[model samples]
Target: MERRLKISSGERLLDRALDEGIALEQECGGKLACASCRVVVLQGMHHLVAASEDEVDMLERAGASAPNARLACQVRGTGDIVIEIPDAELPPACAASSPVRVTPRAARHLAAQLNKHAGAVAVRLAVERSGCSGFSYRIDPAGAIGDGDAVFESHGVRIAVDAASLPYVQGTLLDLVREGLAHRLQIDNPNVRESCGCGKSFSARSS
Candidate 1:
């Protein structure tokens, strides 16, 4: 059985759970050295703040790279969010043979997005625990440089990424393709060893 916890602004999900007298695991003393406090975010993603580099590293090692998987200790701020603490162990790393890339058109498209959002710096790319393949990307507009984030620029367009997302998207080739009068981003990732039939997520090719 799972229980919901109430939290306020500036409060962390894990802290609220502990303060509410819930028995939660903390194998690494909440230092993010161990991936013991993994949680599957059910809803309210925009309201929840982004995770840090260390937290992303821990979660990636645990193979919880879906769009919804987040370390409890890394979750910040208070929002009406739903999450499930899972009983699991840290998994292995995803190794890629190359680096991430983007097409000229995709770069231009991304730049357009940055221009649309006033003061936006770039686009942030991260992996979330999602899809049948156990992993997916969570991309969004970036307003500033984040802690431990890798910034990539091409054709004057920038895309920020966390260390955890490196292996999964290293060999990725991003393009902005036009489909039936609609333009959308397309990703041709070589690190994907397997993907679900629906094509919403992917699994890393173990090296």
Candidate 2:
């Protein structure tokens, strides 16, 4: 089954959804920990299964609207559903523009942090074999610069991707978010398949 959801202004729902070819955001790969992929069910409420306690807890932290907001990771599609993106529920990292044409929110949040800290931090983007989707991201504060690495600067922060991983992450963006008491890094990648529920693994779709 398939579902359709609408994103508010400055949201990248369509881009991220099409890239993964799924109607869910498996942040933490889908671990149900980070609620970055939560969505509101504007229509077809009866089609979805009841929200589990864990999902409800996550939704509470996600600041989702009562009786409507649901985690995309948890709401398995039955036939089709219509969802509206809310700003209050919007992932913190979503923004309007990015240099790499990736998701803007994550990059914007990271940029804000860099500005506040005024410290040098390395952003390394890489893919690892793990998670429900068969792969996940490996993000770390870069320590050393390697030769022939592709680097892009956003909001005065330098993000580097290894030559090998560049293709997989091309046109991807990063964002930092604070949902309730939980804070996390979000990735909006154009090259990803279904991510595990744990947000630690993912699989790439075939060309």
Candidate 3:
């Protein structure tokens, strides 16, 4: 049976649903970390997947009060269902938003280049204060490691992040981009708020 998911205000319901063939809005490409893809299941709640610890934690952080609200990425169709879309969750600046994603090749290349220069490659990913929105990613060479940082390795590249930022970037994919004379790192973040026009800074939802 077909199921329906409703989007809330400022939410991109149809766009995201169509992108994944699930009839939901995923302005950030269905990244669970971003709340834009959130939905309110008006019916058939039993047919949806159970919420994970991560999802619950994020919802709490987002200050969502609706018991039925769920991230579309975390919900899979099981049977016929109904949902409602609200306008408050929709961002007025959706048109100007750019979602970032990372590629495996880029990660490997970055790791190799860093290793060549530093002998030991350390890529520190952190959220910094910048841009008009008040927050942006800060990628710099890690001169020393610190506590509360989670480390992950992919294709010889080491990724380090503090405990606080991990929840926001956990499922994120990283990639590099070159547009005209501009070369920059693109983050396929599901937890991003509207980024600055220059794409250097982002303001994520509270969750």
Candidate 4:
């Protein structure tokens, strides 16, 4: 479908779509964590904010190769733009099985950590393009749930993973490991094909 949207100085494209009753699948709640709301910008690319590294990563994960393809969830700025929403371009949803698993020990540790952080809702799990092996894992306490976050519970703690990161980290297990007197969390991802010798990152198998 074709639409011409004149956004305010800093209006998010996704919000405008919602206001106009347009159907855009924003599986990450406009968190820049998914590509479900991708649109091909036929005009006015210069008026929008430059895409961030995270958004680019998500687009790459979604296999969006077109130079003008932008995620509506992350497109916010001034001016008028013409965009095309391709019906068959939306990425598929995550698998039915839980993409990530947290062990009891890890859940206990995470739950305690969440208590320490102010207003922490769930533990956010994500993959960033970094380290020598192409990707690295990141875990942080999420203060609020995004609209498109894939939430799961293990033991008694909740975990949230953005839809974009779910594809690369599926079948992964989070656990706590103790070495000597120090304790650290570990990620056991079944999708890893190669690990950096420095133990800092890994390359995931194609989804």
Give me the candidate number with maximum TM-score. 4
lDDT of 2 by residue, 94-201 (tens): 222222332245556556654555344656677766656776677665765679677777545678778766666665656556789986776666567567767677
Per-residue accuracy of model 3 over 1-207 as CA lDDT, tens digit each? 234544433334344366546644466665676566666778877766687766764553443447888776666645555766554754332222321223555576576657666644478778866788778887776756678887766445677777777655654556666779975666666668578888778887533
Using Cα atoms with residue i matched to residue i, what is each candidate's TM-score against the true structure?
0.51, 0.44, 0.47, 0.53
- Displacement of the residue 53 alpha carbon in candidate 1, Å: 36
Span of 10 residues, lowest total lDDT, candidate 3: 93-102
Q: List the candidate 2 regions with Cα displacement exceeding 4 Å.
A: 1-121, 205-207
* True-vs-predicted CA distance for residue 27, candidate 1, Å: 52
lDDT: worst 10-residue window of model 2: 93-102
Tens-digit lDDT track for model 1 on 163-206? 77766676465777889999998877666778899988988753
Model 2 alpha-carbon miss at residue 180, Å: 1.7
Error of 2 at 162 (Å): 0.4
Please name the candidate that would achieve the greatest lDDT relative to the true structure.
4
Error of 2 at 45 (Å): 42
Ranking, lDDT, top scorer first: 4, 1, 3, 2
Tens digits of per-residue lDDT for model 4 on 31-64? 7766889988999999999988667656645656
After superposition, the stretches of candidate 3 with alpha carbons farther than 4 Å from their true spots are 1-102, 181-183
TM-score of 1: 0.51
**Whole-model lDDT per candidate:** 0.72, 0.59, 0.61, 0.81
Badly placed stretches (over 4 Å) of model 1 are 1-97
